[model samples]
Target: MLLRLGSLLFALPALILLVLYGVEMSAVSDCTQLGGIYNFDTAECGTEAIPQTSYYLRHSGLVNGMMLLSVLGALAMSIGMLIKGMAQQAKS
Candidate 1:
């Protein structure tokens, strides 16, 4: 019960963030307004374009990738915990 509850808590936040990231990516590509600095004349949030520096490009990708990984990891952990809890209960 405890594991399932904890997994749910973690999974919910991860799923929310993943959905947010997806929305941001889609908005960026669609060139649609995202309010604030993410509006026109910008690539996306936490991103900038530099003439000579590659950091801008790399940083954007890295940030997105990290978020994706976190979401995946959280999902995996949640599933693992739920399975383990079920297995333990079955043995008793």
Candidate 2:
């Protein structure tokens, strides 16, 4: 149970990142098809260059912190499972 949970936690961030990338790529494609520019840095769609910032970019710190926390939690859970398994093996 712990192992499964740990593995899920470990994969959660990568899954989220992939999903976000897909969404952004879709947006960029759609924007281009509609005769607009997709700004990578600001994540905006406009006819011309504009000074803008994306919500994700603005909250990058928070996002990174959450990912880091989840990874740490996954590591802890995996370690716990290992210890539990070791204890069980020693008892037999």
Candidate 3:
């Protein structure tokens, strides 16, 4: 149980980060649709304006990759705990 809990505790942050990356992707893909402010005034109203490329997205990809690695590590730790628990049970 403790192993499962620990795995979940570590996994939670990675999951959150993954979700955040999805949101950031969505925002960057559709900035104007999401009510982003436009600097230039155009004759045609409601025209979608492109958002400037931000370094945040690039850094976010790196963060997402790290989070994925963390998730894998958590899974490995959980499996190790299970094995340890079984060995202890068998010894007793």
Whose TM-score is greatest here?
2
lDDT of model 1 at position 34: 40
Backbone clashes per model, in order? Answer: 0, 0, 0
Return the lDDT, model 2, position 32: 93
Model 2 TM-score, all chains together: 0.67
Top candidate, metric lDDT: 2
lDDT tens string, model 1, 1-92? 54555556555655765676576568665543543234333444433433332333535665566556666666667777778888999999
Query: In model 2, what are the clashing residue pairs, if there are any?
Result: none
For model 3, give the RMSD to the true fold: 6.9
Clashing pairs in 3: none
lDDT of 2 by residue, 1-92 (tens): 67767777777776777687689889999999999988877677888866656646866875687588678768978797888989999999
Question: When superposed on Cα atoms, how far off is each prediction in RMSD?
Answer: 7.6, 3.3, 6.9
Model 2, residue 32: C-alpha shift (Å): 1.1
- lDDT for every model? 0.57, 0.78, 0.62
Candidate 2 has an lDDT of 0.78
Q: Is candidate 2 or candidate 3 better by TM-score?
A: 2
Give the CA lDDT, 0 to 100, for residue 50 in model 3. 43
Model 2 RMSD, rounded to 1 decimal: 3.3
